[model samples]
Target: MTKRKNNNKLELIVAFSWVLEKVCDSEFSLLLPLSFFIIEFVIAIFLFFQFSKEEEEGVEVAAEEVSEEYTFQHTLAGKLWTENSFNSTAFKSTILNAWKLKNPVEIQDLSKNLFLFKFSMKRDLEYILRSGPWSFYRALLVLERVTGEEQPSDLTMHFDTFWVRIYELPLMLLSEVIAKKLGNIFGSYEEMDLKDAHRIGTFLRIKVTIDLRNPLKRGTVVKFKEKNRRDHFKYERLPTFCFIYGRIRHQLKDCEAFEDLNEEGFEDIEEQELSYGQWLRASPLPKVIEDQKKRDSSSGTCSKNIFNVSSGQSRCKTKEK
Candidate 1:
């Protein structure tokens, strides 16, 4: 009996050992696949972080270069001297005179290569003066004739006007007429000043610059009439008074004669031209319906008047019989 019990215990030990070995193999099989997956996931995460960091560094470097390049290229002297000015007419004139004085060769040259540059410089100066210091550098970048380095050498770089009075009527009007002529001469130019006085003043200065390159030599002092030529009554006494009268009327914006001439009520008319006519044009249908109703009411009144007249005529005829 003892031997039999010992044999049974030995068989039990053998079975337990086999089961333990199977369990160990199953756990190893599952863990091996999981370990390989974890290793691949870790590698992917590291590569992603590395690429992101590189891209970020590249962007930072690009931004720095762009800002540095802009600073190097942009300069303030370009706008103040090149672009047109809107502020004081006297100031704009002074600058334009200086520019024209400096760039005579280009203006006289018919090839127009230098003409663009001259005009660009003029425009840049105007922009700088009107926009103030902020746009100075940007305007300089766009200037064609004058370079950033040459601006300081050419311009006075300050605001100063010498007001002088001229006794000659022709010279006084010279500024306005010359400004228009110069604008016509240079098709690239545009008059940005909207106020009549300011526009006239700016144009006059530009003309002076064109005609007299060295305005200082010609006498820096300019005397403009405090009141325009329209204020002078002598303009009306001339034989060609009508032409002068018309021009003055347009300039003053309050001419009684001009108003009389526009008696047809055409001055304020708004014109709208259509390329093609449509069968149905857009309109307020409700307004059309209301107008029709009013017309119908008037027609009803007219019909009643006719009926009354006919009835009265019939009664009169019966009475006469």
Candidate 2:
């Protein structure tokens, strides 16, 4: 009986301590204390969840803000920008000096590798594109000129090029012919000395920048009449510029064939300047042939009565070799 009373006393003490922890009011039902404890626990759990949710939202907002800043500032993108080796000041100064851009309002960094230059002048933007395809520290910098659109649209210029080899013709003469014949379709041309000429052929790099608004971009082939022969050729993007050797990459201007020609001197070739109207008059090949005949007659005994199969197979007219 005494042991049972002691256990009862211990239970009562524990109950009293739990009630004291729950509520200040002693007259209230113990059930109210239990309900109050459950309410507080639920409130704590809700607050914890809300905090976590707010933290996640904050992170997402920060990320979005960073992306917006990048887009708002950059007007150009390329390998040069990705490296972050430069800043807006460098870009502004270089471009302004090189391209003669006047009064650029703002220049800012976009992303890690892009830049934006704000100009009030529309011509300033055009100047950028016209002066672009830049090389800085040996790395090519590609620029995209933004037309100040709120949303990005198709704004790329597409061009095609091909390697043209003119056989049995001189470089200057053929260039003149090509320039005249292809002036409408050919945006520009560069004489590519990718390889040594075979004492006759002329090599050139012809690049045709096509207007996207034109039908020629849809696989159109270029055709022209040369030497009474109708000829057709296609444009190609050739890996021609050799950054190291400063020659056409694929043509190898330093090829072994040119060594012999370099040793023996060549004629002081003169370029014949012909107007556009003259190129259309007739075939210039006849004039070139006449000139060649004159040269051969004077130097190679063409005027002499040489013994030939066409003539008479008679006395030897062969000069000492």
The residue pairs in collision within model 2 are: 81-113, 82-113, 161-236, 240-249
Query: Over the stretch 226-300, how does candidate 2's per-residue lDDT look in tens digits?
Result: 444323333222222321222221112333443443455223211132111111111122243345445544533
Candidate 2, which segments miss by more than 4 Å at Cα? Answer: 1-84, 147-321
lDDT string for model 1 (216-297, tens) is: 2211222355643321111001111011132210211233454554555544522222111111111211243334444545
How well does model 1 score by local distance difference test? Answer: 0.30
lDDT of each: 0.30, 0.38
Worst 10 residues of 2 by lDDT: 274-283
